[model samples]
Target: MQRYFIDSNVPESQKISIGIPHYHHIINVMRHVSGDQLIFVFNAGETYIVTIEEVEKETISCHLTERLEKTVELPIDVTLACGLPKGDKLDLIVQKTTELGIFSIQPFEAERSIVKWDEKKETKKRQRLQKIAQEAAEQSHRVHVPEILPLLTSKKLLLELAQYTHVFIADEEEAKINEQKVFKKLLNTMKINDKLLIITGPEGGLSRNEVTSYIEKGAISGSLGPRILRTETAPLYAMAAISYEFEL
Candidate 1:
């Protein structure tokens, strides 16, 4: 069944109305008709099996058939704070990481970052990335879509580190040191419901001073194994490792 995220309230009568893009997707794109079943994820993060009862010119009416109890979210909330990379690397990172169970994404300006997003560009890019996250979440059958946070500078990101239960930074320098398993060790210390922030630098990677500043703010610097990963690849690796550790 096709899945969609809905923002409106699901009334006690169990009857729901959908409009615009979703209506178009159901009627034109997917060619769904009355009696076809689809999954609806509500704002409260509840998933319901809904049956289309009426297909109008602009609206699709659906009735809740069953509420699903299944959850695919990571036990721990993992937020990715990535330094703005060049090109569309952030798009790839958001889509893949959402599938791999990332909770939220934060794009920051790093000391070595080459790409710059002005105010107007930042708003447009955030809107685009948010749509990507929603689509990815639906495709992955996720009950909750990952949030695309506003852009922040490295200094601003440091100030917000206190909100998370734990913070980890992917440092290339750590990869060169043999027998460093800080990532694994940190994972071992994690528990259910913990909120973790994983930070990765852009193409040029984070500077030494930036890493030191992060460490000062209580973030543990770790390597994503011995190999140096690209800006986009690092977060995916971390998400996969987290899924393996906590889900598998």
Candidate 2:
């Protein structure tokens, strides 16, 4: 069955109406009819099996058939903060990480980052990334879509670090040191419901001073392994490791 994320509350009468994009997707794209069944995820993270009852001019009416009880979210919330990379690398990161169970994404401006997003570009880019996240979430059967945060400067990102229970920065220098397993060690320490922020640098990677500043604020610098990962690859590696540790 096709899945959709809905922003409205479940009706008391168990009747639901879907409009616009979803309606178009059901009617034109998916070619769904009145009797077809679909999955609808509501704002509260509740998943329901709904059956289409009536196809209207601009909307499709669905009747709630069953409320699903399965949980598809990561036990602990894992947010990825990436130093903005050039081209469509960020797009790839958003789509893949959402499939691997990222709770949210934050793109920040790093000292070595070459790409810059002005105010206009930031808004447009965020919208596009958010759509990628949503589509990926639905495809992966995730209960909630990962949020795409507005671009932040390195300094602003530092201040936001306090909100998370744990923070880790992916450092290339750490990869060079033999027997460095700080990332795995940190993963072992994670408990259910904790909030973890994983930071990955861009093409040129984070400067030593930037890593030091984050370390001083209590973020642990860790290697994803012995290999140096590209700007886009590091976060996916981190998220996959997280899923292996907690979900698998």
Candidate 3:
């Protein structure tokens, strides 16, 4: 069934209303009309089987037939703290990671990052990414939409590290990351609701000085693989591995 996320308070009545853009999608692209069925999710575990009942100028009304509980969300909260990458690659990162059940994403300024969002534009950038996260969450059937937070400097990120229990940075240079030790240890030890912070560097990669700083913060090194991965791909790989490590 075609899926869309709606506000949590969507009533349990036979009829439900959708906003203008969604109406356009139903009327135009989807060609949905009366009697067509769709899926509506709160994206935090409440799903309704909806049947199109009425199509109006700016809204499409649907009828709720049944509801189901969602079981797809990750057991733990995973935060991706990525060093701002250049160009449009971050768009892919935000969209795909939201689908993978990441709890939140943070963009931090690394020493070698080529693209910099200054004090003024950082907030706007984050808001845009958050919108993308919401859309991805709806499309991917995620239980809860992931967050895209305001920018942080690497130093600022390190300072806030104590809030999370499992903190690891992906270092292509690290030998320990390749071994099963860090992941195995995480699987054996961490609790379900434990917060996992994953930090990935930028296109220029983390400088030696920056690597030293992260290492000092008790961030154990984890390697992705043998090939040279792009800034965006590395985080996705790391997140998938983390999901496999704990939830599998």
Candidate 4:
């Protein structure tokens, strides 16, 4: 069954009114008609099996058939703070990490970032990334959609680090020094529901000054493994490691 996230008060009425993109996907792409079955998730993050009852010219009406009882979210909240990379690398990071169960993704200006985000393009870029996250969440059966925040500056990111319970930065220098246990040790120390922020640099990696600044702000600089990973690869590796430790 096709699934869609709908913003509606489902408790008051079982009938759901869907229009535009969803209607187009259902009627045009999926060719769904009255009596066809599909799934819809409401604002409360509850999934429901619904049967198409009416298909009009502009809207599609669906009636709730059953409410699903399932939870596919991670035990702890994870926020991935990535240094803006060249090209569309951030797009891949958001999609894959969302599948791996990230709570949110924050892209920031790094000391070594080669590409810069023009202020005029920020809205379009953010919307595109958000759509990617949404689609990935649906395909991965995630109940909560990962939020894609606007790009932040280094100082702003450092200021926000105080809000998280734990913070780690994937530093190549740390890997070079064979600093292997900090990430795993911190994961072990974290309790359920703790919010973790994992920061990684762009292509050339974060500068010594940037790493030192984040460390001073209470961020633990750690190695993903013995070998250094690419800018886009490190964040995914961190998220997968987190899932391995907490979920499976």
Candidate 5:
């Protein structure tokens, strides 16, 4: 069954009226009929099996059939912050990380970032990523859709560090020196529901000054492993390791 993330909560009446974009996909793309069953996920992280009761020109009415169990979200909230990379790598990161159960994603300007966020198209780019995350969440059957935060500068990112319970950075220098336990140690210390923020650099990697600045913000630096992963690969590795540790 096709899945959709709804904008409102499932009311007691158990009737949901879905309109355009969703209605278009149901009627035109998926070619769904009035009796076809689908999944509707609400903003509150609730999933329901809904049956299409009526299909009109501009809207589709769905009656909730059954509520599904909710256990797909990560035990702890993990946000991945990436120093903006080139091309469509950020799109891959957002899509994959959402499937692996990230709480949110933040892209910031690092000292070595090659691509700069276009001031005029910033909102457009962010909306594109948000759509990617929503689709990924629905495809992966995730209860919660991960958010794609607006672009920020390193200084602005530092100011938001206080919101996370723990912070870590993936540094190539740390990987070269075999500094591995900091990330695992931090994980071991954290209980369920803790919010963690991890940062990865761009293709050129984070500058020494940027690393020092992150350290000053109380973020522990660690290596993903002995190998130096690419800018886009590092965040995915971190998220997978987190799932292995907490979900396995």
Candidate 6:
């Protein structure tokens, strides 16, 4: 069944109108007809079954039929911060990480980050990442769409570390990789609404000063494993591992 993300304000027994783009897919591309059943999520853990009523030029209206089981969502909030990698790597990271159940993603400009996104480029970059995340959420059957935060500099991001309950910075030089030990600490220490921010650097990784600044901000340094992972891969790895540990 086709799944969609809708605003929570849409009430039961009322008309469910979808946007033109999705309407086109349902009407023209997928060739769905009246009375076709669909699944919708207002947010995480909220699902509803609806049947198509009318398909028009700009909108598709459906009748809310029944309430489905709440979609499975991650238990903990995990935000993966990547040190903006070069080329299309960031797209893959955002799409896959979203499917794996990350709460959100933030791309930061690290010391080794090569690509620069000024005001003009930042807008376009954000749109592209957001599109990728949305499509991924749909493909993975996620109930809620994860947010892709605006790009930030490492220093600027570090300044806000206090907001998160626990901040884990992925550094290869950190002590041995013990997913259990790190997660155990998180289990023993973390509570609901506690944001877990995981930072991963670019190809060349972060500079010593950058890591030091993160440390000063109280972000604990953690190692993923013995082998080094790419900048784009590291964040996904950290997010998936954390979701497995904390959510499952």
Whose lDDT is greatest here? 1
Clashing pairs in 4: none
Report the Cα lDDT for residue 233, model 4: 92
Off by over 4 Å in 3: 1-70, 176-181
TM-score, each model? 0.72, 0.72, 0.68, 0.71, 0.71, 0.68
Angstrom error at residue 175, model 1? 1.6
Whole-model lDDT, candidate 3?
Answer: 0.77
lDDT scores of the candidates, listed in order:
0.88, 0.87, 0.77, 0.86, 0.86, 0.77
Model 1 misplaced stretches (Cα beyond 4 Å): 1-70
Which parts of model 6 are misplaced by more than 4 Å? 1-71, 175-180
Write model 2 residue lDDT over 64-165, tens digit each, in one string.
Answer: 987876557766789999999999999999999999999999999999899999999999999999999999999999888999998999999999999999
Which residue runs does candidate 2 get wrong by more than 4 Å? 1-70
lDDT of 1 by residue, 1-248 (tens): 24588987667899998998788887898788899877787878787778899998899989999877655977679999999999999999999999999999999999988999999999999999999999999999998899999999999999999999999999887775653689888887775468999999999789999999999999998789877678899999999999888656
Residue-level lDDT of model 5, residues 8-59, one tens digit each, is 9887899988997798887898788989777787987787778899999899
lDDT tens string, model 3, 162-243? 8888788777766343453665455446554578888889987787787788778777666676677889898888768766
Between which residue pairs do clashes occur in model 6? none
Residues forming the 10-long window of minimal summed lDDT in candidate 5:
185-194
